[model samples]
Target: MDGLMPPPARPRPAFTDEELRTLVRPDRVHRSLYTDPGIFDLEMERLFGRAWIFVGHASQVPNPHDYITTRIGREPVIMTRDAKGAIHVLSNRCAHRGVSVCATDSGNTRHFKCPYHGWTYRSDGTLASLPQRRSYPHDRAEIESWMSLARAARVDEYRGFVFASLTEEGPDLETYLNGIRHSIDDLVDRAPDGEVAFVGGCSRYIIRANWKLQIDNGVDLHHATYTHVSTLDDDGRQFSRHGGGPRIMVDGKKSIDWEPFGVVGFPYGHGYQGRPPVETLPSGPVYEEYVRRLEARHGVDRTRQILNYDRFNSVIWPSMTFQAFGQHIRVVRPISVDRTEINVFPVALKGAPEAYNTGAIRSLAATHSAASMIQTDDIEVFERAQAGLQSGAHDWVLFAGHPGSEEPWHEGGWRGQGTSEFVSRIQYAENWISFLCGGNGNERG
Candidate 1:
């Protein structure tokens, strides 16, 4: 029995909300924010407790009582479609004794029966059955009120993507999205039917780094020239002379920087970087076919304009990032101070050519898959970052990419050259730090 149990763990002292404020400052953050377990626990309470988190798509659980289990911050929860076709997010633990109710990863069932006590719950998280009617003197109504599975504070869908927030209060999804909802719209707008679905399941991988590191990388175009050089696989010919500038593509022996390569770091810590179009995808037949369909819906000139705008990587802070041009989305889950998990889903555009979707899936496989050398290089750095930070060699990480050069974005937010730390500052320092430090979520500190 002694060998069956692990050693006792040390208790982490609680930090007052005011104390949490001191760890964050504009321009830099303490290394303990990434390396300390106590701070990690605080993040779960203050940050994850309040922010909306990305769950699986509705398509993933389309059937009655179909469900997938995932976490909100650190709480295990279930996202399921009930018999009535309504989606629900329910705590995975049993109400009776807090035992895990859903043991399997995903499946369809008429009802969830707790393995510990057989207290069953309906898909809507209503109590369905009790082992014995007379186990207690309390009426069934009283039992239901006390024992039904706990539900998420809110569940909402935008453009077929589902999200859940456990905290009862915050900005609604539309307001929280602000301008970045356009990113989701852009993905749906491309389809002739004006919809998208998650078709090619998902790839889940664990990384030994803080989730924020990956979030920072999602919009940091400055790193691509050096960190993802292997992905380009040229003599650096396609890279513009200036770092973070538009990327050039190799044509035979010559390289030319393509048009419309740009990035913008927006309010609510969201932003996008330009990537080649779905039209530029290498899957010959489908690319042309899908374009023809899009052209028919929107005129040729309009189709071309639509396809070229902000179609690359878009980061929705604290939860997920999307690559519309690539037709996949990445959702990050923080597991611990030094561990994170990411789920990548290849999206299928409704009413589009199968070839187009196939091409998107293939592209995702080549770049972000677990075996992808391009992403493997990134993982190496994420791990080394954790290791280095834990070594106590330095007290802070600096984000000084473009000093005193940030400009107001034409619409809103800030615009900087692709190399700037605008995204990092906005996400970690300005927007998210303000949330963690108790400034208004809707305003800058």
Candidate 2:
């Protein structure tokens, strides 16, 4: 939970009703939100500063002294496992002369020693040692207090995924996750052992577009058929020219309708686009036996709910999106006004047959890897959009694919037609609310 203290009230620039309306036109968003450095700074301060952004999974640092360094908004932080087996999210900076404590991406370390000043901190972030004890006796307390790596305001875990809030006051992670909690559950539940762990290596890419562009792209199902045409072309012998051939079947029934992939938009800017089932999944006695075992363990209805749930990709607000069934998570980090860093993590389903986990990994690489043919093209499109927006030719981008087509709001959130941009709309709505209400509004459902 965020516990940030409120700043004294100042005469801030009131984003008037007209400006808010103009910024989030049903069909388009204002260009300033994407291209303005001032707006980008405010977003980092307001949105990322207050939201529960996913840092890394706890399994990534399973060992007692294992640690992983990552960004929480613009701040560099480390997720380290203490000797007592608890994880702490602390600033990577050293108290003595503000140098980074850990330089490598990740590894097992007994303690973090500042390369600059030889100050050391235990993996749990307490000051362990200083080079000279007698240098300043009375200042030892001040030095030690400063030497302890600054921890995050709050750190929490959902399933095994770790999230840290930069601020000191806000809703708990569960309250923020709302309807999207099911996505994480569905991912872990698919594992025969009811657990999932990061696998393979992470893929990192730099995109020359605003971070929101990447978020919008995740829920845009219609682009796949066009932008990823090369992937479909490569598999033309099996899939039809339009990227549709036959429905993948499981248990003598069609698994997904290729024509319509649904989208579900929840409060707090979380949402997902349903992914069509893979037609290439090997079917036969092996598949049947696996299904039978699952049915026996979870019952017919529960097993059906697990396997037949339509969503393929889910976006957790502000940052982090993953293809649950595909076993991959993407962390989006805003580098600047028009620059972003995206990290992709492949996951292995624990207790599932090795073959099944391998299949999921292969599928993730084929579709979402940094060097993926499909993903490369998608990045190019985003870059082109960024380039075009800079030319002053367009002032807004439309998100009104399904205007007047909102689904009845339910306990699970709003459902929409497969091709709709309602997910993006919902995200921007929450984004505006977060910026306007200072992280305390009742915008979360």
Give lDDT for model 1.
0.74
Error of 1 at 429 (Å): 2.6
Q: Please provide, for model 1 over 108-175, each residue's C-alpha lDDT reduced to its tens digit, 9 standing for 90 to 100.
A: 98899999889999988888988876877897677777788888777888988888876667788777
Candidate 2's TM-score reads: 0.86
Give one digit per residue, the lDDT tens place, for model 2 in 169-214. Answer: 8888888898888889878887666788987778888899999888
All candidates' lDDT scores? 0.74, 0.75
The reply for model 2, stretches above 4 Å from the true place, is 1-22, 25-27, 137-144, 234-260, 277-296, 299-301, 409-411, 440-445
> Considering summed lDDT, which 10 consecutive residues are worst modelled in model 1?
1-10
Error of 1 at 409 (Å): 3.0
User: How far in Å is the alpha carbon of 207 misplaced in model 2?
Assistant: 1.3
Q: In the order shown, what is each candidate's alpha-carbon RMSD?
A: 5.6, 5.1
